[model samples]
Target: MAGSLLVSLSGITARTLDGCLDLATALDERGVPLSLLVTPNAEEGHRSVSDWVRERVVQGDAVLLHGYDRRVRDEFADLPAHEARLRLIAATAALEDTGLRTNAFAAPGRRVSAGTLKALRLHGFAVYSDGSTVRDLRGDRLLRARLHGFGGRGGAGETARRNAFVLAAARLVRRGELLRIGLRGADLDRPGRWSALLDAVDTALECGVVAATYVGPAPRVTCSPRGSTLTSVPSGARLVNRP
Candidate 1:
């Protein structure tokens, strides 16, 4: 069976909305829908971008709350359950004021504490995708995010990172496993970064992977870790730290 590929773009603020839109257009032409990560309190620019955001959602792209603010890195990384709940309430309300609403979440920097998970469960978030796993809250299961491609910071190691990411995509597709690629809004201005992402997507498609959206039903897992469980998760917030 062919594996599924989920493409998500984050860091979308007023400045990067255009680039994000361009990339979304390219994905749409290939029949791939993007899962957009929006930050409600990022900057003063969101008010201007609200209309554009709604347009994309109307076109079938999946919208998710990335974090409360872009200035705060790893917003959910170290919060307690009570604090997490408070933050979510504030963030979701801000998003609603913008005329966008979503229960799905992707934390900034793909880091989340166990408390973050508990808060998401309580808030009725349907799904949460972090660095290593995608948790389906309603279904109470975990899906390993085996292959990921993230935008590179400028440096000598950038090329190596891109190469490794492409190779990982190829391997996942050949093995029929889930492959996730996350692009940032800054990637468009970075030389070769945008092209590298396109290369990874093309490489996966050539290997027969189907494009997927995180907003849709959770993809069925062909394999899961033996003896692993998320059932005891709620009780172990402090004991089972992910960060």
Candidate 2:
């Protein structure tokens, strides 16, 4: 089967409401399937973004757990499994309080560990994805997350990181591999950038690659011996870790 276009938008703090929505609206209008990997609440922004997220879900978008407040991004690795599970449960419950329910999750800033993986499987999560793989972790199957938004507007390291990912992502698609691309609501500030990304996605779709949420089993993957690098991940993979 052809791979999918697993588009996910991250960093959904209140300030990014319009930019994020603009990007999401563009994708939705194109009939692209999406996963709104959103932070449950923002400490500073309006609640409209969260409400909009809920509406998107009702309109057929998938919601994945991002984080609690997003301030604790770097600490995901240090969180004990019990605490991790509790946090996720709390976050999901909070979403439900807003009338949205989900069994999917993505990490915030740290690398998701074996402990986090186990916690996700036990806490009603059936699918998990990170910078390395979009996995049916419950079944030991690999999934694809091809493209992700990269580059911080001002940081050199962030720019380098995004560039590196762009190179890698391009290689995968060129090889006829299927993967998910990560999108960010913040990037919508420069509409041209997002427009270009959508055009690239359209190019991939015209090549006969599937352009929707990925569903089903994938290749077996193992933890990279060091760092978050996953060896042998398929081209159609999507997602990322925290820290």
Error of 1 at 159 (Å): 2.1
C-alpha local distance difference test of each model: 0.74, 0.62
Query: Mind giving the per-residue lDDT tens digits that candidate 1 earns over 141-220?
Result: 77666437554567888888878878877787787677788888888777577777888888878877777677765444
Highest TM-score against the true fold, candidate: 1
**Alpha carbon RMSD to native, model 1:** 7.1
Model 2 lDDT per residue over 1-243, tens place: 343456778877677777877777777777776777766663655367667776776666677777777767554677778878887888876676555666667777646867778788788677776775666655566643434665456444654554555555555555456556787767777545565576666665665565555322232222223313222322221222213
Model 1 lowest lDDT segment of ten:
232-241
Runs off by more than 4 Å, candidate 2: 42-46, 144-147, 154-171, 214-243
TM-score of each: 0.87, 0.76
Backbone clashes in each candidate structure, one number apiece? 0, 25
- Angstrom error at residue 184, model 2: 1.5
